[model samples]
Target: MFLHSRHLSRRVAIASATALLTGGAAAGAAWATTAAAAPAGPRTCTVSDLYVSMGRKEGAAGSLYWPIRFTNTGTTGCALRGYPGVSVLDAAQHRMGAAATRTGGAVSTVTLAPAHSASAVIRTTNGPVGGPCQATGTYLRVYPPASRTAVLVPAGWKVCSGTFRVAPVTR
Candidate 1:
């Protein structure tokens, strides 16, 4: 979903504050759990310029072949996490992340370079939602690292995001 620049700013404010409030002490918990279960990533660095590409329809409901592109654009590689987040803003649907409900979308393992990019597809459907999916704009905002704690959202420090559109798979 395309968020207006102003609205995006507000979303940032809400999301940041929420993260801060929830993550303050939780950050330590996450570290404790992750330290033993995982190894250090590509490196220790700040994440920035997170964004998603325009979404594609994937032929709608029952038969979906929709594609979404992703890129890191961060100073260092970051985990794409469990599933590529599929954010849907439907007055009728009323869902947060459509992919959360749908089972086909999968986030691939690829390291996004400063400008490098990749595309992935929802190969099959488990519980696909039908849509007259009228995408207003092609892009979704990126949620910055849950661990980025700061008194202020700094300059040149952009939260990640992507547009919503359909296209051939790119890498």
Candidate 2:
């Protein structure tokens, strides 16, 4: 017996559809596997992996700027994105005033290799700017982004509540 032309065309159509579906599924699986096997970027930098320090003081227009440096002391590379938490502390290890607010800047992920460094700028005034000096700071407490732990860098400044601002970390 011989098949009709209509029946033969329908069979071919079905076979073609099946082949396309199978090939598409296999291609999708292969793509997924390749993507999964790709290596990931560096992890976020933690306080334990960094050595924080205060850079030289700079002043302009009655505002004080300090470049807070974060050096990667770990064995591997890490990343630091966004702003670092900054606050003034008195001699007794107590918070002197309100925490430093985040200032405007181009925020991007800063990848630091081992022994490399990233920095952020903390701005305040020597005496007072927008408000009265709330307390005198003997040490500046710094918290790296996304980290709960904080490190203290020796600093002598008059701190005003809601007056301190910090820029984002950069290379």
Candidate 3:
């Protein structure tokens, strides 16, 4: 038996679309591992377990808010001096702002309990165009220095980045 030409073309198109969808789903899952629940900040040492969530505030133009959580995954305690700041870039990767604040405040130290998580907020004064980040990348600096100097949260520590998305709030 022979199949019609139209049917054969349709089958090929469906297969290609399916493969693209599958690849996209896998990429999303891999990125999720980059951010995870953590155990606060370590004391007396430098350990990092930081997670950052990005979103836009209502009526806040050119601004992005970062709900940041820094935790200690190690056995010892560590001191977290500064939170990773926000960097907004345009389509051409031009630096719009650097090290933007997640929230307005002065945080010197935060001690994390074993197997616990500490949370903070960091925001940008000069923001991304259209009230949403053109591109959002978070950075964390380890105090007392750590085995690794700094971690760009989006690059994915073990796997792909957690979730770098535009969470728009409607009404």
Candidate 4:
């Protein structure tokens, strides 16, 4: 009876140790997965870190579309979310009209590494709806997402429509 009891105790001890080891391994695996899935926080792209430019222009149905590109010029990775503030500027650097309206789009965070770029689509009507264009614009003033400073991009053609719409920044 004594020998039998000892064998039973040994079996229970082995089982307990096995369970503990299995549970620890599972916990460790869960922690590893969570750590791997966690995203690294990136800084917001500042006006100095970004270079704004216009891409090829396209027109359809009396509306013009231009791709506004923001290139990350800094050495570190940065993020841009939502739409950029856009406005037409005359040669004297005065705002020609109200800021561009934000069009509906999926506003997701875009991480840009050094030298990488993201683009937003700007749509403007061919002409003013109510009256003739107030003034010819020589440049397009662009403000980075969540930034107050503006970047001036040369406009090859004058913008007739005072109102414009801008899509969200995308990869």
Query: Model 1, 1-171: lDDT tens per residue?
Result: 245545655555565565589866455544444344344355422334444553454454444454455556676565443334333433343433332223434433444566655554443331323323333322333322232421121111101122232222335
lDDT of 1 at 95: 32
Q: All candidates: CA RMSD in angstroms?
A: 17.2, 11.7, 21.4, 12.3
Question: What lDDT does candidate 1 reach at residue 81?
Answer: 37
lDDT of 4: 0.82
Q: lDDT winner among the candidates?
A: 2
TM-score of each: 0.36, 0.78, 0.38, 0.71
Clashing pairs in 4: none
Backbone clash pairs for candidate 2 read none
Candidate 3, 88-151: lDDT as tens digits: 4444434444433333345455565545455444434343333443344233332222234443
* Decoy 4 TM-score against native: 0.71
Tens-place lDDT digits, model 4, residues 78-163:
99999899888888888887878999667999999999999998887777755566566789999989999999999854455465
lDDT of 2 at 65: 86
Ranking by lDDT: 2, 4, 1, 3
Worst 10 residues of 1 by lDDT: 151-160
In candidate 1 the C-alpha lDDT for residue 165 amounts to 24
Q: What is the lDDT of residue 16 in candidate 1?
A: 57
lDDT per model vs. reference:
0.40, 0.83, 0.40, 0.82
**Which stretches in model 3 have alpha-carbon errors above 4 Å?**
1-63, 85-97, 101-103, 125-148, 155-171
**RMSD (Cα, Å) of model 3:** 21.4
